[model samples]
Target chain A: MTFVIQLMSGLAVGCIYGLVAIGFSMIYRAMGLVNFAQADIMMIGAFLGYAILVAAPGIPFWLAIIGAMLGAALLGFVIERVAIRPSVARRADQVYLVLLTLGIGIVLSNGARLIWGADPVVYPTGLTHQTLTLAGYPLPAVYLYIAVVMPALLVGLHLFFTRTWLGLALRAAADDPDTAATMGVRPALATSVSFALASAIGAAAGVLYAPISYVSFDMGVIGVKAFAAAVVGTLGSIPGAVLGGFIIGLGETFGGQLIATEYQDSIAFAIMIGILLLKPTGLLSGARR
Target chain B: MESKSPAALALTGIEAGYVAGVPVLSGVDLEVREGEVVTLLGRNGAGKSTAIRVICGLLKPNAGRVELHGERIDGLEPAAIVGRGIAVVPEGRRVFGSLSVEENLLMGGFAHRRGIAPKLDLDAIYTSFPRLVERRTQLAGTLSGGEQQMVAMGRALMAKPRVLLLDEPSMGLAPMLIDAVFDMISTLAGKGLTILLVEQNASEALDVADRAYVLERGRIRREGPAERLLSDPEIRASYLGVG
Candidate 1:
């Protein structure tokens, strides 16, 4: 019963990491760059949703989520255009992309700090803090919400990629930008669209998380786990990202439980290094290059 | 006897090179008439592939003009040029290795910005490459070289290109496979597709080409009807290694 509880708890958090990892994987596949600022977007998104919900108390919590997503999408699009695209046009080194994103992460994190301050704000997600007991084990209903919603969103994303033309165009851009261009997929458009989609998803994770936990500036620290998940799943694969997230989430939980709690973070890193030594391509690497 | 059709694609003075100091294409000129198959024949390092790159907007020419159906298209991006109906089967059969055969076809169908190409669909592509139908779910990188080539060609066809540019379509293929590829090329031409086929195999290229241009160091050294070029004793002996 404890194991099942731990697994569910781990899965709920893992699904959030998985969502953020999807953003990282999609952006990496499309632009050949790891966006370190992905988690920062999560923090900012939560704040935006929180602000809107506070501003209009009568609005449903879901409306705040939609508004937050729209905010993230527009902000992400602008960031790609203003901050990322010119550096790309200049044909900067791969390291430049990493550095640029890191710099952006610092800026966004600090900017949130300026607005929200250093304190953690309580989130009124309107869900009663009810605990559901399964076989004498207590489980937070919020985790159940994440467990169901995240998978549903992942399925929706899969459908978008496989069934829709624009979604196919995004994947095409990731596969071979040059050949994708020959198929009339504008690399710029693909990049922008990817940024928008990724940021929106990141924001969605943030909104879902804020209700369950305190919204704070350093919430992005959790993003590092998601980044690790992306690396463990092989850098650019979507399904790999989700699987990696779940593995990391579960591993961290079990590691904390069976071993020492303080070493949970290191478990993800240890697993990453172990996988690198054995299968450097990652457990679910789809990249041939 | 020249079966008359207007030039569907044309290039003049296509000066291009990857490296700044070395020009791969210098003062090259070529054209493909509507519903005709034109082969750009050259030996290795003869800028045949570069010419295709320039025509397809993969590489910009340093100095020259490219036109399609009498409209200028030199400065446009590859995506826009693709939207204008120029599709390329690039050298070495550059299939998206990670994507499935079906996904590859879907990628190829991204030839338009908004909608699927009406002339080609998953079923249509599967019909054209029956082997691909059998292995639709398989990853493209795992396929044999000839199979990869079929996917590459099938991908281009999914675009329903107005001017198809094929770069060294026979490279790294078995002799029988080369014949099969050429037969497919001829079949595509028979269906009124305008083709610019680039090849190092002059003999195989000439067998299917309606007109031919001999590119030597980025310049047209010889140009004529394919039959005329094939019959030229000195040309055949010097370039094609036949007499």
Candidate 2:
């Protein structure tokens, strides 16, 4: 019964990491640069949702989620245009871009602190605390929602990439920006759309996570764990991101349960190093070069 | 030839290069009329690919003008140039290796607007390259060299390009595959597609083109009908490697 409970809790956390990792993977694939600010973006979304909830009491939880996603998407557009585009146009080195994104992350995190203050805020427990007994074990309703929502989002994303014209254009841009341009697909526009989509998904993860973990200014570090998950899954594969997130989540949970709870974070990093040494391509197959 | 408009693609005084001040091609002029095949013949360093790059708008000319159907497209981006009905099967068969053969063909149609009439049919592409139909789901990188070239050509055709720019379609192919590629080009031209082919394989290029130009040091040294160029004593001795 304890094991089942642990697994359920681990799965919920893993799904959130998977969502954030997918955003990192998408942006990296499209632009060939990791958006280090992704976690800060997720934090911004959570804070935005909190603000909306406070500004207008009695707003439905689902509506808050949608509003947060749209807000994050708009924020993503602005960040891409103002922060990323200039550096890219100059053809800066990869290390420079990485540093730029790290700077952006710091700015966003501090900006969130300025607006929302440096204290943790509790989100209303809306259907998340409700418990259901399965196999004579108590399971949180939020776990079921997380499991269902993550898989559904993955399926929808898969269909979008496979069936939609815009998704096809994004994939083409990722494959070869030069050839994609020749195919009449503007690489810049495709990149903007990729960032927007990734941000919205990250915001969705934020909304789901808020009720589980109280929203705070320092919530962005969770995104670092998501990055570790991305690396475990390989850098760019969507399925790999999800699998890596789940594996990391389980590892953390079990490590805390069996070993010292203080070292749970270390377990994820150790697994990441092990995977990098053993199978750098990740568990899921990804594009070579 | 029947009475028709001027060349589907025409470039006049095209000077373009990578470096800001150093020009790779100086005053390079080329043309491809409707239903005609033209070849640009040159050695490795002779600016053959640069001419194609400039025509396709991949590299903007430092000083020249390009006209497609009489509309100037000298400073336009590559996507805009493609939207003007020209497609290049770029050098090295640069197919999207990560995508499947079918996905690659579908990407070729990205330029067509949402409500516009479909220009190219998938069935036609599959019929043109039957092997592609058999392996539509396979990743493009997994294909053999000849098969990859077929995908590259099929992808260009899917765009329904009025003028096709083929750069060294014969490079790295076996003798049999080279013959197959030439046959495909002839078939496309027979179907009314204008073609500007750039190649180091002078004999094969001359055999397939209606007109030929020999480029040396970024300038056209000779221009004439393919047969005349092929039979010219100077051309035969210096370029054709025929006594």
Candidate 3:
């Protein structure tokens, strides 16, 4: 029961990490930029949902999530246009892009600090109170919600990528933008769409995560862990992101339980390094590169 | 204002290179009429590929006016150029390593399906390349060089382009494979496709060209009918290697 309980909690957190990792993978695959601001977008999403929910106090949870997603997607589009597009036009080096995203992450963190103050905002009363008994262990209802919903969302994304024309274009554009252009897929449009989708997915992960954990400006650290997840899963493959998330989550949970709770954060990264050293492409990577 | 010409694709005064003020092509002019196979023949580093890249809108030329079917297309985005009915089989057989052959071809049909009815669908493409039909499920990265070249050409044809630009289609291929590729080029021309072929294989290119231009150091050294160049002593001695 203890093992199952730890596994359940790990998986719930892993799904959130996976959600953010999917954004990282999508953007990186398409544009070859690691997008350090991705995690900060999650922080923004959590705060936005918190603000909206607090203002009404009667608004449904799902509606709050949808609103946060749309708002973050728009914000992401603006960021891509204002910050990213110009550098890309100039054909700036990879170091410049990485620094630009890091700068954006710092700005977002400080901006959130200015808006929400330095303290952690507690999640809603309803969330902490709800619990579900599974396999003789009492687990948070939010974990169950995350564990179930994230897989479904991933499945939907898989269908979208395989079946839709836009999705095919995105995959093609990622491989070779010059060639994709010759096929009539606009590279500019594809780049923007990738930003929008990545941001939306990152925002969704944030909203889903906040009810289980406290919302804080510093929570972008979690987003960085998601980056590790993406790397662990192979940077470009979608399935790799999802599976890498679970692996990181489970590793942290089990490591904390077995050894020292203080080393939990370090364990996720350590496992990432180990995996990279051994199987660099990740556990479920569909992409060779 | 650019002149309205009936040529399928035309380039005038095209000056371009990777670095500024160090052009590989200076004052290069070329044109391909409808349903004609025009060969750009040159020695290594003679700006043949550069000329094709300029017309394809990959590199923005320092000074040039490229027109397709009487409309200017030089400064347009590469995607828009494709929409205007120009496609390129780039120098390397740059097939998407991760995608299946079928998916690669499907991506090729992207421009053709742009909110309009598609002219060259998957069925037509598979029929044109029966080898591709057999290997449709295979990943492009795993294919042999000849098969990869076929995938690259098949991918280009998915757009049903009005003008096709081929850059060194026989590069790195065996002699047998080169002969087979040139045969395919002639066949494509026989079916009425307008093509701009860039090659170092001077003899084979001339064999398939209706018109030919010899480029040397970013300038057109000579231009004439393909048959006329075929018999020229200078061309025979220098390019044809008939010592």
Candidate 4:
């Protein structure tokens, strides 16, 4: 039962990592820039949801999640236009974008600390309080939510990429920006949309995560773990990132139980390094260089 | 080439290159009439590719105008130029390697907003390149050099372009594949597609083009019907090495 419980918690945590990893994958593929601020963006989303829940006490949790997603998406658009796009236009190197995103992350984390204080705050449990009993096993309702939501988002994203014009444009830009531009798809617009979508996904993960972990400034570390998962899965493959996240989550959970809990973070990093060393292209099949 | 309509694409006094103050193509002038296949012939660094780039809106001309059906397009973006019905099969067959062959075709149809609509049909492309149909599910990067070129051409055709610009379509292909590519270009031109073909393979280019321009150091040194240019003593001696 304890093992099952640990698996459940790990899976939930893994789903959050998967969501953020997918966001990173999308932006990286579209513009060839890793938005290092992705995790802090999630932290900001959590703080926003917490503030709204406090201010309008009767607002439903689902509504708060939606609002946070929209807010984060809007913030993503503004940041891309003002910060990222200009740097790209000026032909800055990838390292410059990395430094810029790191600065953004620092600003967001410190800003959250200023607004909400450094103390961890209790977020409403939503459905997480509910528990499920299976064949001699117990699972948190949040774990079930995570499992369902992650796969559902993956399916939706698949449909978006395959069935929609906007998604096709995004995929085309990701493939070859120059050729895509020649085919009447604006690379800049596609990249902006990618950033917005990534931010929304990050925000959704934050909302889902807050109920389980309790919102805190330190949650940004989870973003680093998610980045590790993305690297493990192959930086650009969406499905790969999700699978990598689950693997890391499972490893961390079991490692915590069987080994030292303090090493949970280290376990995720070790898996990432192992994957890189073994198959540099990642576990999923795709182009890496 | 007897259509009374304006040329499908025209460039006058176009100047462009990669670096400032050191032009690769200077004062280059060319035109392709509706349904005409015009070949741009030059040795390496003779401005064949530069002229194509300027016309395709990939690079802005340092001086002069590029017009498609009488509308100036010199300052337009590549996407906008595509919207104006020009598609380029760029040099080196830069296919989207990660995408399936079918997806690459679909991307080609991205520019054709509306028309007879069959202009950008996948069936048409597949019909033209049947080999691509059999390998539609495969990633483009995995294909052989010749097959990748076919995919690149099929992708451009998916745009249902009024003017198709092919840059070195025969590059890196085997002798048999080169013959096949030239045959396809001739067939496309026969079907009334206006084409601007840039090639270092002067003989094959002349065989397919209705008219030909010989460029040297970014300037047109000779221009005439393909047959006339092919038989010209100077062209045969200098470009064809047949004298």
lDDT of 1 by residue, A1-289 (tens): 5888888878877888888999999899888899999999988898998888778876776778789989999999999999999999999998988999999988998999999898987655555376777678887766666766687778899899878878877877787788878878787999999999999999988987876677998899888899989988887888888888888989898989988989999997887788778888888864542
Please, what are the lDDT tens digits per residue for candidate 3 over residues B24-91? Answer: 99998888998999999998899987887788788899997899988999898888888889888888
Error of 4 at A247 (Å): 1.6
Off by more than 4 A, model 1:
A128-130, A133-136, A286-289, B1-6, B112-121
Model 3 lDDT per residue over A162-227, tens place: 667888888888888887877778888899988988998888899889988889999999877898
lDDT tens digits by residue: candidate 2, A7-51: 888888889899999999999999998989998889888888888
Model 1 lDDT, full chain set? 0.86
Model 3 TM-score on a 0 to 1 scale: 0.94
TM-score of chain A of 4: 0.93
- DockQ, 0 to 1 scale, candidate 1: 0.57
Better of 2 and 3 by DockQ: 2
In model 2, the runs with Cα more than 4 Å from the true position are A286-289, B1-5, B113-120
lDDT per residue, candidate 4, A40-123, as tens digits?
888888877887788787687767777888999999888899889999999999898899999989888888888889999977
Quote the lDDT for A37 in model 1: 95
Which pairs, if any, clash in model 1?
none
Worst 10 residues of 1 chain B by lDDT: B111-120
Per-residue lDDT of A162 in model 4:
73
Tens digits of per-residue lDDT for model 4, B1-243: 465666789999988989898999988889999889999999999988888778877789989999999899999998899988999998998898887788788888887644545334988888889899899988888999999999999999988899999999999999999999999998998999999999999999999999999999989989999999999999999989899
